[model samples]
Target: MLVDDQVPIEEFEGTEFPSPATVHMELRYVDRLLHIEGTVDADAKGVCDSCLDDVERHIHVDVDERLDPHSDRENDPFGESNVLAGNRLDLADLAQQLVLSDMPMGLRCSDECKGLCGICGANKNTGGCSCENDTENHGEPKMEDAAQ
Candidate 1:
């Protein structure tokens, strides 16, 4: 059975996160559990780990979930509103779980990202920059080579 007839939560997917490309959903209520199925488009931007340049990546999110009222999780670090009470349920938690569960831990624009140069702090993704190579005074092995 559907909860609210006036405002449908299904209308919110594509609008809230329009850059992902598309979103479609199917929701059902049964035995105090909410079954959800959907797809979402997502775009994420962050500083590149290598060059420290702004990086953007787009991803597709597939959503399928079963949600039951969780009243005992007052200690959750994210927040308390994730759980609903009584008969009135919150669909927001289900959305949050689906998004968080599948999010990539290491996000990069590409696999071979030439990050910022250590000597000059130039964005290696762009190209060459003239910087002093401090090999003697620093006396430390190349951090990049160690990583490799």
Candidate 2:
């Protein structure tokens, strides 16, 4: 979870990573600084950007950081900050920041995911609808929409 001192960074490759992945941390004490270099892997599952069906995707990240011990502000040279109280450090906050930093801004299952149809609620991936473009301005309105 947290690597305080200096050690080999952990490997989180393959499918063991969380849905959003956690940055693999390798710590090293250099003079008066802590250096971290590693990677993060995450397999996320969410509705397709084009379709409303479940889709799974992977996110990968490479991280390299340095933390200064004597600085008034416990911020890494990379501009990422860690709350440090003397020699004692908060691992929870550090991990949270790493995970958040590795998270993708915008992700999709596939570039060509044909999402659900707006009119008939049909999945376009399985040829459930012959609406051609799957536009919202199609055919008959649903009972819910008609009542409104």
The top-ranked prediction according to TM-score is 2
Top model number, lDDT: 2
lDDT of 1 by residue, 8-95 (tens): 2222322223242344567687785666577655555555556656666665567666655444244343544344434444444444
Candidate 1, poorest ten consecutive residues by summed lDDT: 4-13
lDDT of each residue in 25-57, candidate 2, tens digit only: 676778878776776555655555566566556
Clashing residue pairs for model 1: 20-41, 20-42, 50-115, 50-116, 51-115, 51-116
What's the CA RMSD for each of the models? Answer: 8.0, 9.0
Off by over 4 Å in 1: 1-23, 30-32, 70-89, 130-148
lDDT, candidate 1, at 54: 61
What is the TM-score of each predicted model, taking all chains together? 0.54, 0.55
